[model samples]
Target: CVNCGKLKADLNDTSFADKVKHARDPKTRMSVVWNYCKTKTICETDAIEETDPDMPDEAAPVKKGHGGCGHVQPQIRKEGLKLFLQYKKT
Candidate 1:
Protein backbone atom coordinates (compact mmCIF):
# COMPACT_ATOMS: atom_id res chain seq x y z
CA CYS A 1 0.00 0.00 0.00
CA VAL A 2 2.98 2.25 0.41
CA ASN A 3 3.47 2.23 -3.34
CA CYS A 4 -0.16 3.10 -3.87
CA GLY A 5 0.07 5.96 -1.41
CA LYS A 6 3.18 7.26 -3.12
CA LEU A 7 1.53 7.06 -6.53
CA LYS A 8 -1.56 8.90 -5.37
CA ALA A 9 0.54 11.60 -3.78
CA ASP A 10 2.53 11.99 -6.97
CA LEU A 11 -0.56 12.06 -9.14
CA ASN A 12 -2.11 14.86 -7.11
CA ASP A 13 0.96 16.95 -7.79
CA THR A 14 0.68 18.43 -11.26
CA SER A 15 4.42 18.81 -11.66
CA PHE A 16 5.11 15.18 -10.84
CA ALA A 17 2.45 13.96 -13.28
CA ASP A 18 3.92 16.18 -15.98
CA LYS A 19 7.36 14.78 -15.36
CA VAL A 20 6.23 11.18 -15.66
CA LYS A 21 4.00 11.67 -18.71
CA HIS A 22 6.89 11.11 -21.08
CA ALA A 23 7.89 7.85 -19.41
CA ARG A 24 6.69 5.33 -21.99
CA ASP A 25 7.65 2.17 -20.11
CA PRO A 26 7.41 0.85 -16.61
CA LYS A 27 11.19 0.85 -16.23
CA THR A 28 11.52 4.47 -17.18
CA ARG A 29 8.56 5.52 -15.03
CA MET A 30 9.90 3.54 -12.10
CA SER A 31 13.07 5.59 -12.25
CA VAL A 32 11.01 8.73 -11.80
CA VAL A 33 9.08 7.32 -8.85
CA TRP A 34 12.23 5.89 -7.32
CA ASN A 35 14.08 9.18 -7.50
CA TYR A 36 11.12 10.96 -5.95
CA CYS A 37 11.04 8.55 -3.04
CA LYS A 38 14.78 8.92 -2.53
CA THR A 39 14.58 12.67 -2.36
CA LYS A 40 11.83 12.46 0.24
CA THR A 41 13.96 10.18 2.45
CA ILE A 42 17.38 11.74 2.02
CA CYS A 43 19.26 12.41 5.21
CA GLU A 44 22.74 13.31 6.37
CA THR A 45 23.57 9.86 7.77
CA ASP A 46 22.44 7.82 4.76
CA ALA A 47 25.87 7.50 3.09
CA ILE A 48 24.55 8.84 -0.15
CA GLU A 49 27.97 9.66 -1.54
CA GLU A 50 28.53 6.16 -2.91
CA THR A 51 25.12 5.97 -4.55
CA ASP A 52 24.23 7.33 -7.91
CA PRO A 53 21.56 10.02 -7.62
CA ASP A 54 19.68 8.49 -10.52
CA MET A 55 19.48 5.05 -8.93
CA PRO A 56 16.41 4.12 -6.93
CA ASP A 57 16.78 4.38 -3.16
CA GLU A 58 16.01 0.68 -2.91
CA ALA A 59 18.81 0.04 -5.37
CA ALA A 60 21.16 2.62 -3.85
CA PRO A 61 21.65 1.45 -0.26
CA VAL A 62 22.98 -1.92 -1.35
CA LYS A 63 26.65 -2.50 -2.09
CA LYS A 64 28.03 -2.81 -5.59
CA GLY A 65 28.83 -6.54 -5.26
CA HIS A 66 25.25 -7.53 -4.68
CA GLY A 67 23.02 -8.39 -7.65
CA GLY A 68 19.78 -6.43 -7.97
CA CYS A 69 16.50 -8.26 -8.53
CA GLY A 70 16.12 -6.88 -12.06
CA HIS A 71 13.82 -4.08 -10.76
CA VAL A 72 10.69 -6.24 -10.69
CA GLN A 73 9.29 -4.43 -7.68
CA PRO A 74 9.70 -1.09 -9.36
CA GLN A 75 7.96 -2.34 -12.46
CA ILE A 76 5.08 -3.59 -10.35
CA ARG A 77 4.87 -0.30 -8.51
CA LYS A 78 4.88 1.57 -11.79
CA GLU A 79 2.03 -0.53 -13.09
CA GLY A 80 0.06 0.20 -9.95
CA LEU A 81 0.59 3.89 -10.40
CA LYS A 82 -0.57 3.72 -14.01
CA LEU A 83 -3.69 1.81 -13.04
CA PHE A 84 -4.55 4.24 -10.29
CA LEU A 85 -4.11 7.18 -12.63
CA GLN A 86 -6.30 5.58 -15.24
CA TYR A 87 -8.99 4.94 -12.69
CA LYS A 88 -8.74 8.49 -11.44
CA LYS A 89 -9.00 9.96 -14.94
CA THR A 90 -12.24 8.17 -15.62
Candidate 2:
Protein backbone atom coordinates (compact mmCIF):
# COMPACT_ATOMS: atom_id res chain seq x y z
CA CYS A 1 0.00 0.00 0.00
CA VAL A 2 2.03 2.88 -1.30
CA ASN A 3 -0.57 5.39 -0.19
CA CYS A 4 -0.48 3.95 3.30
CA GLY A 5 3.27 4.47 3.55
CA LYS A 6 2.92 7.99 2.22
CA LEU A 7 0.15 8.79 4.65
CA LYS A 8 2.09 7.42 7.60
CA ALA A 9 5.28 9.25 6.70
CA ASP A 10 3.36 12.43 6.01
CA LEU A 11 1.49 12.25 9.28
CA ASN A 12 4.67 11.47 11.18
CA ASP A 13 6.38 14.42 9.59
CA THR A 14 3.52 16.71 10.45
CA SER A 15 3.57 15.62 14.11
CA PHE A 16 0.11 14.06 13.85
CA ALA A 17 1.22 11.22 16.08
CA ASP A 18 -2.26 10.82 17.50
CA LYS A 19 -3.97 10.34 14.13
CA VAL A 20 -1.18 8.04 13.08
CA LYS A 21 -1.45 6.11 16.31
CA HIS A 22 -5.20 5.77 15.99
CA ALA A 23 -4.89 4.84 12.34
CA ARG A 24 -2.28 2.22 13.16
CA ASP A 25 -4.11 0.63 16.06
CA PRO A 26 -5.99 -2.51 15.08
CA LYS A 27 -9.27 -1.44 16.67
CA THR A 28 -9.46 2.15 15.44
CA ARG A 29 -7.75 1.70 12.08
CA MET A 30 -10.82 -0.07 10.79
CA SER A 31 -12.25 3.39 10.40
CA VAL A 32 -10.10 3.58 7.30
CA VAL A 33 -12.73 1.38 5.73
CA TRP A 34 -14.97 4.40 5.54
CA ASN A 35 -12.30 6.41 3.79
CA TYR A 36 -11.49 3.69 1.28
CA CYS A 37 -15.13 3.07 0.49
CA LYS A 38 -15.95 6.73 0.30
CA THR A 39 -13.16 7.16 -2.24
CA LYS A 40 -14.48 4.44 -4.54
CA THR A 41 -18.21 4.96 -4.09
CA ILE A 42 -20.66 7.76 -4.61
CA CYS A 43 -23.84 8.55 -2.72
CA GLU A 44 -26.98 9.79 -4.42
CA THR A 45 -29.83 11.54 -2.64
CA ASP A 46 -33.04 13.30 -3.54
CA ALA A 47 -32.89 16.90 -4.71
CA ILE A 48 -34.37 18.22 -1.48
CA GLU A 49 -31.92 16.27 0.67
CA GLU A 50 -29.05 17.37 -1.51
CA THR A 51 -30.19 20.98 -1.33
CA ASP A 52 -29.92 21.06 2.44
CA PRO A 53 -28.57 18.26 4.61
CA ASP A 54 -29.33 20.01 7.92
CA MET A 55 -25.99 21.81 7.71
CA PRO A 56 -24.38 23.65 4.82
CA ASP A 57 -21.72 21.77 2.89
CA GLU A 58 -19.46 24.74 3.16
CA ALA A 59 -18.09 26.23 6.35
CA ALA A 60 -20.22 29.15 7.38
CA PRO A 61 -18.63 32.49 8.08
CA VAL A 62 -17.20 33.00 11.59
CA LYS A 63 -19.75 35.59 12.60
CA LYS A 64 -21.12 35.81 16.12
CA GLY A 65 -24.52 37.29 15.24
CA HIS A 66 -25.36 34.57 12.70
CA GLY A 67 -24.44 31.66 14.98
CA GLY A 68 -22.06 30.37 12.39
CA CYS A 69 -19.34 27.73 12.84
CA GLY A 70 -18.99 28.56 16.49
CA HIS A 71 -18.02 27.10 19.86
CA VAL A 72 -20.53 24.31 19.47
CA GLN A 73 -18.31 22.69 16.87
CA PRO A 74 -15.07 23.31 18.74
CA GLN A 75 -13.24 23.32 15.45
CA ILE A 76 -10.41 20.86 14.97
CA ARG A 77 -8.76 23.56 12.95
CA LYS A 78 -5.18 22.72 13.94
CA GLU A 79 -5.53 19.10 12.92
CA GLY A 80 -6.56 20.09 9.39
CA LEU A 81 -3.93 22.79 9.25
CA LYS A 82 -1.22 20.31 10.16
CA LEU A 83 -2.37 17.83 7.53
CA PHE A 84 -2.56 20.60 4.94
CA LEU A 85 0.91 21.77 5.76
CA GLN A 86 2.22 18.23 5.46
CA TYR A 87 0.49 17.78 2.10
CA LYS A 88 1.95 21.04 0.83
CA LYS A 89 5.38 20.11 2.11
CA THR A 90 5.27 16.81 0.31
Candidate 3:
Protein backbone atom coordinates (compact mmCIF):
# COMPACT_ATOMS: atom_id res chain seq x y z
CA CYS A 1 0.00 0.00 0.00
CA VAL A 2 2.71 2.44 0.97
CA ASN A 3 4.72 1.44 -2.06
CA CYS A 4 1.74 2.13 -4.25
CA GLY A 5 1.77 5.71 -3.09
CA LYS A 6 5.42 6.07 -3.88
CA LEU A 7 4.80 4.94 -7.43
CA LYS A 8 1.88 7.28 -7.94
CA ALA A 9 3.72 10.22 -6.42
CA ASP A 10 6.75 9.45 -8.57
CA LEU A 11 8.84 9.72 -5.45
CA ASN A 12 11.51 7.55 -6.99
CA ASP A 13 11.60 9.83 -10.03
CA THR A 14 11.92 6.72 -12.20
CA SER A 15 9.70 5.06 -14.70
CA PHE A 16 7.66 2.21 -13.23
CA ALA A 17 7.73 0.37 -16.54
CA ASP A 18 11.51 0.41 -16.61
CA LYS A 19 11.76 -0.83 -13.04
CA VAL A 20 9.43 -3.77 -13.60
CA LYS A 21 11.37 -5.10 -16.58
CA HIS A 22 14.48 -5.24 -14.40
CA ALA A 23 12.98 -7.43 -11.67
CA ARG A 24 14.16 -11.05 -11.37
CA ASP A 25 12.47 -14.14 -10.00
CA PRO A 26 14.01 -15.83 -6.99
CA LYS A 27 13.48 -19.34 -8.37
CA THR A 28 12.28 -18.92 -11.96
CA ARG A 29 15.28 -16.79 -12.88
CA MET A 30 13.02 -14.01 -14.15
CA SER A 31 9.72 -15.51 -15.24
CA VAL A 32 7.11 -13.62 -13.30
CA VAL A 33 5.09 -10.54 -14.04
CA TRP A 34 3.92 -8.51 -11.07
CA ASN A 35 0.59 -6.93 -11.82
CA TYR A 36 0.45 -3.43 -10.44
CA CYS A 37 -2.81 -1.48 -10.91
CA LYS A 38 -4.15 -4.24 -13.07
CA THR A 39 -1.19 -3.66 -15.33
CA LYS A 40 1.40 -6.35 -15.80
CA THR A 41 4.32 -4.36 -14.40
CA ILE A 42 7.80 -5.52 -13.51
CA CYS A 43 8.64 -5.85 -9.84
CA GLU A 44 11.13 -3.75 -7.93
CA THR A 45 12.86 -3.76 -4.52
CA ASP A 46 12.13 -1.72 -1.45
CA ALA A 47 15.56 -0.18 -1.50
CA ILE A 48 15.88 2.35 -4.33
CA GLU A 49 19.33 1.49 -5.63
CA GLU A 50 20.77 2.63 -8.97
CA THR A 51 18.46 0.08 -10.54
CA ASP A 52 15.71 0.44 -7.98
CA PRO A 53 13.31 3.21 -7.08
CA ASP A 54 13.30 5.81 -4.28
CA MET A 55 10.83 3.99 -2.09
CA PRO A 56 10.26 4.45 1.61
CA ASP A 57 13.32 5.01 3.78
CA GLU A 58 12.56 1.86 5.83
CA ALA A 59 11.00 -0.54 3.37
CA ALA A 60 10.78 -4.28 3.95
CA PRO A 61 12.12 -7.05 1.75
CA VAL A 62 9.68 -7.75 -1.06
CA LYS A 63 8.24 -11.23 -0.87
CA LYS A 64 9.13 -13.40 -3.86
CA GLY A 65 6.39 -14.35 -6.40
CA HIS A 66 3.89 -12.06 -4.73
CA GLY A 67 4.04 -9.66 -7.69
CA GLY A 68 3.42 -6.65 -5.55
CA CYS A 69 6.46 -5.92 -3.45
CA GLY A 70 8.92 -6.01 -6.37
CA HIS A 71 8.79 -9.42 -7.95
CA VAL A 72 9.67 -8.80 -11.61
CA GLN A 73 9.83 -11.18 -14.58
CA PRO A 74 12.95 -12.41 -16.38
CA GLN A 75 11.91 -11.29 -19.84
CA ILE A 76 11.08 -7.88 -18.49
CA ARG A 77 14.53 -7.59 -17.00
CA LYS A 78 16.17 -8.40 -20.29
CA GLU A 79 13.93 -6.08 -22.24
CA GLY A 80 14.45 -3.27 -19.78
CA LEU A 81 18.20 -3.52 -19.94
CA LYS A 82 18.10 -3.62 -23.72
CA LEU A 83 15.96 -0.54 -23.92
CA PHE A 84 18.11 1.22 -21.39
CA LEU A 85 21.25 0.54 -23.37
CA GLN A 86 19.58 1.62 -26.57
CA TYR A 87 18.50 4.86 -24.97
CA LYS A 88 22.01 5.46 -23.73
CA LYS A 89 23.37 4.98 -27.22
CA THR A 90 21.28 7.86 -28.44
Best candidate (score: TM-score) = 1
Residues 15-82 of candidate 3 have per-residue lDDT tens digits of 65455546665543223323333343344444443424566645745533322455333222256447
- C-alpha TM-scores of all predictions: 0.35, 0.19, 0.16
Residue ranges of candidate 3 with Cα displaced over 4 Å: 1-36, 49-68, 73-90
| lDDT over C-alpha atoms for residue 79 of model 1 | 61
lDDT of 2 at 41: 18
Write the residue-wise lDDT of candidate 1 on 4-88 in tens digits.
2323223545677787898889998889877765544211121235656778888654533212122212222256447332122
Q: Please give the TM-score that candidate 2 achieves against the real structure.
A: 0.19
By summed lDDT, the worst window of 10 consecutive residues in model 2 runs over 66-75
Better of 1 and 3 by TM-score: 1
**lDDT pick, better of 2 and 3:** 3
Residue 68 C-alpha lDDT in model 2: 19
**TM-score result, candidate 1:** 0.35
Model 1, position 10, has a per-residue lDDT of: 35
